[model samples]
Target: MRILISGASVAGPVLAYWLTRHGFSVTVVERAPALRKTGGHAVDLFRPAMDISEKMDVLPRIEELATGANRMTVHPESARRPVRADLTKIFSAASDRHVEIMRDDLSEIYYDATLGDVEYVFGDSITAISPDGEVRFENAAPRRFDLVVGADGLHSNVRRLVFGEESRFSTFIGAYLGVLTLPNTAGLDRELLIHVGVGRTAGMYGAPHLGDARALFLFRSERELDYHYRDVRRQKEFLREAFAGMHADVDHWLDELDRTPAFYFDSITQLRMDTWSQGRVTLVGDAGYCPGPAVGGSTTLGVVGAYVLAGELARADGDHERAFPAYERAMAEHVRASRGVALSAAKTLIPTSRLGVSGLAQGARLVSALPAGLSRAFLRLTTKSARLYNSMTIDDYPPSPAASSGRVGLGVE
Candidate 1:
């Protein structure tokens, strides 16, 4: 079967790897000119995602690239000293497992794993898709495929074209996030420092491996901001207005915002759809059911979704009629559970008032002061979002001849 996948990031490459292993001809089309190497924050790989990575033979590499910041310090606006928390313990209690790695590192590992086995069409995008599995691209010739899967991010072109207007299916969660790279002037080493202000949070942490520091910003908003998602100048202006005179650290970070080579800004929104498939064209990962952008375990959810989608297709002998529905059924409960956490995460991470910020700091201090065992138990008892990470079981599909053969290496030019 000839299968076409969109957005060669997290889900797309994983789907390509598994589909190719299941004896399907896979082609991936990415809008970017090349693999995106920067401008993304660190993402967690929970137990289920780790298991999938192990099966894909990339777990060791993932572990090697895991973020070294096992500690997190919270700086309150009124406090002279920051409250420190052990991130390792906090994350472990929420989910049985935790492997935090940079987003681009994970994508690079997945892309390298399947590069030789799949045909990647970079610097192009799908312009149109017909009901009969025909696809047209902006820079490539039109082609027909047995199936097309949209593993694209929140603003998916495939979802927009096949599922109609995105606004109808999108649920804004009243927040916005920005990330960029800057010089490591703070001299932080393997530690994360977060500053919390009224209804806003700004953080800077050192990335020794990359020889730079990363600045992360999050703020609350009642409604979605009106601006172009791709317009960097307008996005910077929006951020400047939202974070004006917030803190000395924020001002220092913003001083170099214009010089930063790449900057990412977007709203924290969720995509909810009654169905993710229309005929032979379907959706996976953020394109179909993104619980939340940064707060949600979106990367973990995407990896698991890609695995199940491909496994169901292989089980049904590449029959979309059977695979699509099965994929949805298997993912419905998990997706719903993950979405529930996003609502509370936004309020907790970015408090709405000065009192709320203090409350957050106090909570962190209380959690950090507890004994190791007590702390883990306390976090596990209070964090409902952590349980959602391992909510589903990944079924094993029989390996095909392609998978039994020697694996492929990075094939990029």
Candidate 2:
């Protein structure tokens, strides 16, 4: 079977790799002229996602690029001084195996792994999909595939083309997030310095290999903010208003917003769909059932989802009729758990009250102050409530040589 996957970020390339490994021909379509260089925020890969990466023989490289953000200094609203925390210990207790890699780095690793074996069509996007499996592209000629999967991000073109408007399935969870890339003037090395204010939080961090440091901002909003997602100017204004007078450091970080090289802002929204599949086309990763962005463990979910979707397709011998439903059944519990986690994080991580801000500080102190054994125990206890990514298991699907049919774009485009 020949499969075409849209959005060659995390899930698209992952699915393409596994599908071809299972002997099915695969092609990936990306709208960008080339790979994305946004250097997105750091993303966590828990035990299960790490296991998937290991099986692909890319774990070492992934670890090579891991963001060594091992320490945190938080200045809470009510606190007179900064409270320091050991992020290394907190991470160790959170999962048996974990790696926090920059999002763009992880995407590049996955994309590079599938280079020669997979067909990649950059600078084009899917415009339409017919029930008979005919996919129309904006730049390339129309092509037919046995299956089509949407691995695009939250603002997915594939999802919109198939499902109705995103608002129908998207729920605003009363929060917003912004990130900017600027010079690492604070001289933070493997450290995250943050200010925790009522209903908002701001941080700046940098890695050794990074040429510029990144400033992160998160805040709670009772109602959706009035601004277009593509309006960068409005986003900067809103972020400024939210974090105005937060602290000298944060104010300094915000001051560089106008000159930053790359900027990203979006609502911490969740997608709740009755079903991710319709006929011959189905959705995967954020394009389908994104629990939420930053706080949602979405990167892990996307990797695991791609692995499962590919495994199911191969297991059913390219029979998507069987594979699609099984894939949904497999991911249902994980999705539900992650959604709950996102909702909780929206309030906890970005506190809405002074009391919540203090709790956030005390919780960090407790984590850093505890012994190794006790810390892991406490983390496990707290994680049982928010650590669905670690508990979820990825089913094994060894490659089937008999599963592949024909190849597409074998030589050149």
Candidate 3:
């Protein structure tokens, strides 16, 4: 089977890896000219995702690149001193196995794992898709494939072409987020500092592995802002306006926005689709069912989805007729569970008022002051949504006869 996957980020490369392992020819097309190396915040790989990574033989490398920050400091707008919490303890309590690695690092690890075996077409994009699996690309010749999958992020081009308008499937969570790289002037060493104001947050943390710092902004918006998703200048303006006069620290971060070459801005949104597959085309990860950006464990969900999608295909002998529905059935409940957590998580991260922000800061301080065991227990009890991380069970699929005999190899280049 010849499979074409759009977007070479986490889910695309992962799906490609499993498909090739199952004796299918896989080709990944990415819009970026090369592997994206920077400008993404840290992403968590909970137990299930770690298990999948181990199966892919990339866990050791992911561990090697895990973020070194062991603590998080919450700075309230009115407080003189910040409240610090131990990140290691918090995550350890959440899961027996947890790895927090930079998003770009994880992307590179997945890309490297598949680069030697799969065909990668960088600096191009799909313009259209036909009912019979014909694909048109902007910079390359049109081609036909047995199947097409969209692993692209929130605003997926493949989803737009195949599933129709994005607004139909997109759910705005009444907020916006922006992340950028900056200088480590905070002198942070394995620590993260977050400043919270009414309905807004500005954070600066060290990225020791990348030898720089990262600035993150999340602010509440009652309605979705009207702007081009791809326009960096307009996005920057929106961020500045939303966070204006909230804090001097935020102003400092915004001042450096124009100087930063790599910037990411997007609405805090979730993608909810009733069906992930239609005929020969389907969607995976954020393209199909993103709980919400940043707040939800989207990276973990994407990894699990890729594994299930490919495993189902292998189990069905590469029959989309059987595999697509099985994949949807396997992931439907998990997606629903994730969507339920998105709204509350967003509200917690970006509070709606000054009083809420203060209360959140006080709660953090109280949690930090509690005994270690007590704190962990308290966190586990309070964070009911964390269960979403391990909600889906992975079923192991035996390698097909062709795959077991090493029949799977690089397809026509």
Residues 284-395 of candidate 3 have per-residue lDDT tens digits of 9999999888888889989999999998988887778899999999988888888877787787778888887887787676666777778767766776556667455778
Tell me, what's the RMSD of every candidate?
3.8, 2.6, 2.3
Instruction: Give the top-scoring candidate (TM-score).
Output: 2
Q: Could you tell me the TM-score of candidate 2? A: 0.96
**Candidate 1 structure quality by residue, lDDT tens digits, 1-413:** 78899999999999999988877879999999999986688888898999999999999999888877777889988678888987766766667777888899999999999978999999999999987778999988999888899999999999999988889999998999999888888888778889898888999887557678889989888878989867889999878888888778889999889999768899999999999999988999999999888888889999999999988887777778899999999999888988888887788889988888998888777777787778767766676676566555768877654444533221112
Q: Candidate 2 lDDT, tens digit per residue, 1-413?
A: 67889998898988888888888788899999999998578888888889988999999999888888899999997578999999998888778788988889999999999989999999999999988888899988998887889999898898899998999999999889999999988788899998998899998889887877899999988899999878999999999999988888888999898898899999999999999999888999999889888888999899999999989987887777888999999999998888998888777789888898998888888988999789888877775433576578768998765654443222212
Q: Is candidate 1 or candidate 2 better by TM-score?
A: 2
| TM per prediction | 0.94, 0.96, 0.95
Off by over 4 Å in 3: 405-413
lDDT of 3: 0.85
| Candidate 1 local distance difference test against the native | 0.86
